[model samples]
Target: MMFEKIANKIGKYTVLLISLLIALILYPALEQYKIGHICLTLWSLITMVAIVVSLNENKKTSKRIQLASGVLFLLIGTLLTRQVLGLSQEFLYHLILPFSFLFIAYIIWIILSSIFKRKSLGADELSGAIVSYLLLGIMWGLLYSYIEFISLNSFSFAAAHDIQAKGSALFYYSFVTLTTLGYGDILPISRFARMAAYLEAVTGVMYTAILVAGLVGHVGRHR
Candidate 1:
């Protein structure tokens, strides 16, 4: 009962935490402060925990899976903080990106399962849909970052910033592209980058369609 209560609390707050992350991504000016990276890292950890807690409420996913995801997220957060603080980078920080993306993808699966397992859509289910969309964008952003890192000039940002700021730039660009909002400030130059952008754009459209269809079907069936 205590665990259920905790899960419920986390589920209720999922939307608020996600909104904060989106706010930070949209307003990069807040990231200029030294504390900005810390905020982002901490927020990421909490979000991961909240997601796992909410998923556990369904009892469909195993405890081992949840624990693994939580540990992976915690590790990524720790590595991110260390990288930001210049504490450690010997183990290759970029390598962690792929794992983080995988973890996010798994989280999306859990959220989707939870959403469809219900007979009727509630506020939590709707919020989970939004979170899944956001996670998709974030996952693609990590892919873009990895591509750019491996191949120079893969993507270009209009705003001039240091190499360290590329992560934020790619994230902003990914969301813009995901929403099909071509701001033209960031351009994908390489073939891989262009392909990724195109794929994500299509995926976004398809995801919207699928989510709406699923929700409508569920509502109709229940009604």
Candidate 2:
């Protein structure tokens, strides 16, 4: 009974938690292996599925299943093109980044709608808020990767690393910038890159402040 209750309580959060864990721990740990990119691709697909499932929680069962199926189809196509097709990484990035941006935008809209709705905060709403913040970091990381792909040497790494700005490195940089950490190990050198870095930093600060204020106001009204 206790296990069942715990499972029910965390059911809504399971996918989100798994996505976070894969990105933060699993991906990073396996990144040095030959299967790293494969894992990364799988991670992205899983994240997309999680977002679709979360957004469709209120829809009819049939409609939810249909939407999830569509998303899965699209993600599978992307994965095949990346892995099976003899396409350059740059070409793959060009193809995927636009769709990735669209997916992130849609989920952010849905999550923010849930967060700002005039209702008592619940586990769903709280998780949506947290996921939305992480999504922002991911969105910025994608942008950073895109910028670096188009223009080499856009970001300078202080450490003597053979790989340029890409993959997990850019994500780490994004979160660091988002938190305004400015670690200086990775520095954006180009004009646009600098602008993006600072913009993310500002957005991070503003988002935290606004989210806290909104949650507090909601709590006060409920009381």
lDDT of each: 0.75, 0.71
Could you estimate the TM-score for every candidate? 0.84, 0.81
- For residues 1-223, what per-residue lDDT tens digits would candidate 1 score against the true structure? 4444754665543553465467556447655665676666666676666565556565546585586776677677677768577785535546667777777788778778878888877776777788788788889988888887778788888877665588778988898999999899999999999999999999989999999998998899988
Write one digit per residue (lDDT tens) for candidate 2, span 126-214: 87688788888888888888888778889987765534225678889999999988889889999999999999999999999988998
Q: In candidate 1, which residue ranges exceed 4 Å CA deviation?
A: 1-27, 58-60, 80-85, 88-91
Candidate 1 Cα RMSD after full superposition onto the native fold (Å): 3.0
Clashing pairs for predicted structure model 1, backbone only: none
Residue-pair clashes per prediction, in order, are 0, 0
Q: Considering every candidate listed, which one attains the maximal lDDT? A: 1
Residue 52 C-alpha lDDT in model 1: 59
